[model samples]
Target: MYLRRKPIFFLFLLLHPVFINAQFFADRLKSFMSTAAVSAVQYPKEVKEFYELNSYRFSWLEKQNAEQLALLSDYIRSSPSLGLSAGDYHPEIFPIAAIHENDSLLTEISFTDAAIHFLHDLMMGNKAEPLSYDGLKYVPACYNAAALLNVYLSPGRFANLLTDLEPKEAGYLAVKTKLNAWLKITSAEKYEDVAVAVSKTLRGNKNGLTRLYQLGFVASDTASLSEPALKAALKEAQKMFSLLSDGELRSTTVQALNVPLATRIAELKNTLNTLRWLHCVKQERHVALVNIPSATLLLYEHGKLVIESRIIVGKKSTPTPTLSSTITEVILYPYWNVPYKIATRELLPAIKRNTGYINANNYQVLNSSGKVVDPYKVNWRSLSAGNFPYTIRQSTGCDNALGLVKLNFYNPFSVYLHDTPGKSLFGLDRRYFSHGCMRLEKAMELGRYVLTGNAVAIDTLTEKGCLKNQSPITVPATEKIPVFVLYHTAWIDGTGMLHFYEDVYNRFSPGRKP
Candidate 1:
């Protein structure tokens, strides 16, 4: 017993240092968190009182602005934990800055839309550091002021907002600046109370033929939409329509609505009414692929999922056929397989540039039907452009258009994932450029993401489509991955707010008013 006790005592002595260090680290983390909480508690009231008196004083709330001051005092007191601070929460500065500068018209738009959008985007998983600074530093003061400005500046587009001013702009903008964008969205008033009423007002402003014309425009463009977001927007619009009576919208009493502005507004609203409420703003915390409107691919990295990424998709006309797809494989140094369209359309033209266009590019032509045609016997130019048979294949080398990688997926459409030389387009808001094949922005990382049980490999394929290789429809991979192209502009998020994005495609979808 004594011998066993001696050994146990020795072991504890050996382990004691590690246990004490862990406890120390744990205490350090707790101390920092506690300190952060304390710091956050200090200055929100100063922020709130400051926000209200300056912006809402002239609006409808002006008659009672002073009476309402104490109501926000409690909220103002709790704001530090909310991240409001001095060199910090100078609330109205952002919009005023834009207004004062006059250069950033985009920011000139009611800052709440942008601010709320930014917050929602952050919550949905976008990087939030820049937004955090802007929100805390610029939004509180900017919120009500910007809301007033959005209505004031674009009355034609935002006339209904005059009613929204009733709610405390400080509370509204607080949600906008402090919360994530997704959460702010769900903060909308009940649909029947707000959405239906707005729709009725906008629609009532128009006459019959104009309304039909608007619906006609919506029906014509459903083709541009990919599922889910469009479907959801349509759902919300229809519901909003039913909530208000036809008479309410068409009441002959509303005189100004009968003007041309009302007609256009009605048209846009009618089209907007068709959008459905799909699962957008993925607060569901899903890891699925998201397609964007205006026809681009978005990978929801964080909560808001609005990162501008580059992708090469099918070209227009012979345009990469549009359809839903998921990412499945990542290949390095991908060999280019001259697409059937490219083989027939582009190769011959290149050969004219030089017979070597084929030999030099590692591409060889096939003849009349499906058989390989000799480059020697055919009068390449005289051949009818439409009926030409051969295929082109390139032997692998450095000049391959596919560049260093490929991400492949299975789609009935014969479309696959690949890399491109154009790296610049990824940063654009509109990324509709591509030829049926999907291009990746982070090829290497995406490749590693989808790779399966194979040797954790990063191998490159050298069989350039320019060569004489078998033109198999499917390149059997040792593994497959899941990649999808989705379009989600709004939905209840983790915080349960309906987040919205710009209807980039404008395809039969609109951000239905809250």
Candidate 2:
């Protein structure tokens, strides 16, 4: 009994070192607050205290030579990165396993269990929902990408979004490409029986694998599935799914089963005949493309539109042209140019009357060949408002129409998204206030997103030298990422009550008649 007591004494001493060391770090943090006024919108103090205690526990575990405890400590120390608490594994914020049914064969499923456990923990509310850093700040971002998919598909299931593509139209269209690849692996040309068995297991299982399979197939851009084609597709999916761990799959298996089977799939006949079934209904963008009442921008992802605030858009006289585009280039310090229309109508008339008018506004005179002519060398009065064929380029620096940054995308309209120095508009409920470019409130966050992501370490296009005119770099996405800019006059807020915003663009109710 005396000998046993000695061992306990030894353990106490081991933990003493960790306790003493951690106290110093905690004091330093408290001292920091003394010197500075605390920042507004800070996280709860309990959060900070928990992390500090995690450090102390980590030290104590390390001294005891407990590797598992030490690892747990490490996770606690880096809780922000792990998105977990000390010795705690939340079981609900995410999914346990995700079962995707094979597309080609109507009865097969693809299982990915590795990542499901972590996701399942998050979804169960066992852990803190981690925040995502959006450039300059952080906000509550979803921990589970799969859960995001669930939220995404909630309003309208997979088949409903693709009303444009008929079941027979799956040959080479971009929308059908994803399905074609998936079908190649799932149909089991390589092992037909295995494919059928897999599908049967998913459908028969209570876990919703069948629905996932259905969703995956519907989201794809394929028209038909053959045994060989589907087998090939599943092979690819298997490779992608292998990245997760077994424990994860076990956790989210339940969430994977929760999906709404979606309206009457088996009833769609043409899809069955082609060894493929696709929903033939589509919801138009008209409803999503309208405006809100307040002065803010309505944001959208995929086809589902949600209005956050009301915003101003370019006047229709010089209306913003709608087109397919992505942010390609982001200029840190931007230059403004007098658009051709403005030059021809506004500046040209002034130049014809007052010679010094061009100099006063800092507009540079340029010839037809795009060469800058000295302001003094050219006869400003010689150019008539109707003959304003020459270009008027604005110099860089302050007072430029565009703020400090501008995002460029390829479009026939030569329009670029940007930030404006006129912050007054942010307060106005009616914010439709641009010539013809997107003005973003969260432009910095957009920049951060564009800069971070996966890229192939292929050939270095350019090894050295400063790269100006930074063109848009296309990053092939492994998962579906949707972006939408929309306008809605009415939407449900947190309390689910309908809210309205000012339709500054007048796109919602044309002429504001309603």
lDDT of each: 0.37, 0.37
Tell me the deviation in Å of residue 258 in model 1.
Answer: 18
Q: Given candidate 2, what's the lDDT at residue 432? A: 59
Which whole-number lDDT from 0 to 100 does residue 81 have in model 2?
A: 26
lDDT of 2 at 10: 44
The segments of candidate 1 whose C-alpha lies over 4 angstroms from its true place after superposition are 1-309, 318-322, 325-332, 366-377, 427-429, 452-455, 459-480, 487-514
Provide the lowest-lDDT 10-residue window in model 2. 104-113
Q: Write down the RMSD of all candidates, one decimal each.
A: 23.4, 24.1
- Candidate 1: worst-modelled 10 consecutive residues by lDDT: 129-138
Q: Tell me the TM-score of each prediction against the true structure.
A: 0.38, 0.36
